[model samples]
Target: MADFNYAFISLVLLLPLALLIFLYLIVRPRSVNIPLKNRHVFITGGSSGIGLALAHQAASEGARVSILARSLKKLEEAKDAVRLSTGIDVAVFAADVRDYDAISKAVDEAGPIDVLVVNQGVFVPQELAEQDMDEVKFMLDVNLLGAFHMIKAALPTMKNRVDRRPASIALMSSQAGQVGVYGYTAYSASKFGLRGLAEALQQEVIGDNIHISLIFPPDTDTPGLVEEEKRRPELTNIIAAGGGRMKAELVAKKALNGIKSGSFIIPCNFEGALLSVATAGLSPQRSFLMAFLEVVTAGIIRIVGLCFQWVWYDSIQKWHAQKKRT
Candidate 1:
């Protein structure tokens, strides 16, 4: 019994070391670097907001940038904006993502895409019972199905890149995608679908050296956001209060950095970082260190996540009770 106790200490110490080595060598994520310079980067919804900002950033980084949107005028404005900001004249393509044929033709005209950013989304925040079915369909068609169209059109050439360098496909999700919120039912469903798409697509394309990045940005200050705010429910305003808004430029910068590094999950702020850890799930990791962190902290982060859920539930209950009294 004395010998066993003495040896137990050494065994415990050796176990962690052995596990770490296993994680580092056998279970570590595969490292990939998806370069942006001189490569073609196609961004949807690039005429405004996050997409436009990403276009400007990519052009500044010497990528052959292309902006796609439903509005010709907006695309032209985006082109001029990029030219003025970065001295790079980006190609402009007008196509609605809901129209797969138009997206296909646009992809053909754009030549080959080394990086594709599916950044277009629309949100009309209201409770499910009060929301129009058309609005719900619009969100799904644009936010979720649109991503499918863009990737389907771009993948063949992206997979066959002669340069043999890594390529990236990024989907612009929302923080709401990670967790359901007060008034984001339609939008959340659409964005949450992207996580599943990104995960499965990564498995499908990893052999071709194509990587996927799912970017989750909180409330971003943009023209669309102003419109959304006017229609936002009071309960939603209270529920979404603390996340704070990120400027489009900052969000774009974080997104571009994540794309370049081939990050599978790109969280855009401090709260987002916590959400990322808490909801990491089965998302692929390409960084060994991040994989280790996920493994080590999964349990604790889940507990934290549950605490957050409790707070959210409490808020919902209080809001409902207050309404009853009124």
Candidate 2:
């Protein structure tokens, strides 16, 4: 009986391994690929957060980045940060991704974008029972419809212009896109729709060689997160928390790397990858495996952050007490 169990486990592993190897032998990895150097890259929501971090990283890799967002002041700041960090001149375009005309105008000004990163998004936490109509509309308009608008604007250049190499289109998705969260009724709907859109677009433009990459990032820290924490209500804990926020720079790095590699679905971190697997393997109710893992990761990070906060507060308190005593 023990021998039978061992044999069963080995067969389960080896069967999949054998099938994967067979597929690999049939179609080997592509060797010739364009590096980011001197490439014209466009990013939505690039004025802050992960998009800005990516702009900085891409500039370091010798890519000319065009940062797009609604705020002109923020765009200038982003350009300065990228220039200071990488000594690469960054161009800023103030445009709302939700507006197709604005996105098209920005793309035209950028002059044939070789890489397009769709990162514009909005996060609203409302329980399904109490979900406001406006909240749902806002999330969909920004997260799903915004991505659609950008993709449509770029499709012409990506399809007809006949660039020397294939242009890559990257969409910023979330782990919530791949799996369901308790209080993410609107958010999950938009994200899931984004993933579906990217996959369908991948099929539409595969012949044109417009490489499409959908990035599924876990919680990441960004400039906007300060406002996020301040505005967070009770529902925020369930749907809006970063869940062990990774550095923005790291998320940006992964996004570009995934694009260059032609990865269809990019998981941002180890936890994201694990969650992706768990999402595929487990049933909805049995999704506690992924939930538990996220909890454990978040708990560790929170403990560390709280400890630092506590120590700093204590030191300040001690200094005050000593000054008063003296």
Alpha-carbon shift of residue 48 in model 1 (angstroms): 0.7
Q: What's the residue-level lDDT of 88 in candidate 1?
A: 90
**In model 2, which runs have C-alpha deviations exceeding 4 angstroms?**
1-17, 25-34, 233-243, 280-326
Leading candidate by lDDT: 1
Local distance difference test, per candidate? 0.90, 0.74
- Model 2 steric clash pairs: none
User: For candidate 2, lDDT tens digit of each residue in 174-282?
Assistant: 8878766656778889998977787677768767767777788877888666665565544345333434458888898888888887766677887676555544322
Error of 2 at 174 (Å): 0.8
Model 1 over residues 1-326: C-alpha lDDT tens digits?
99999899889988777777777786424877888999999999999999999999999999999899999998898888889989999999999999999999999999989999999999999999999999999999999999999999999989888987888999999999998888899999999999999999999998888889999998999888999999998878776765667999999999999999989999999989888888888787767667777777889999988887788788889988999999
RMSD of each: 2.2, 9.8
Which regions of candidate 1 fall more than 4 Å away from where they truly are? 1-17
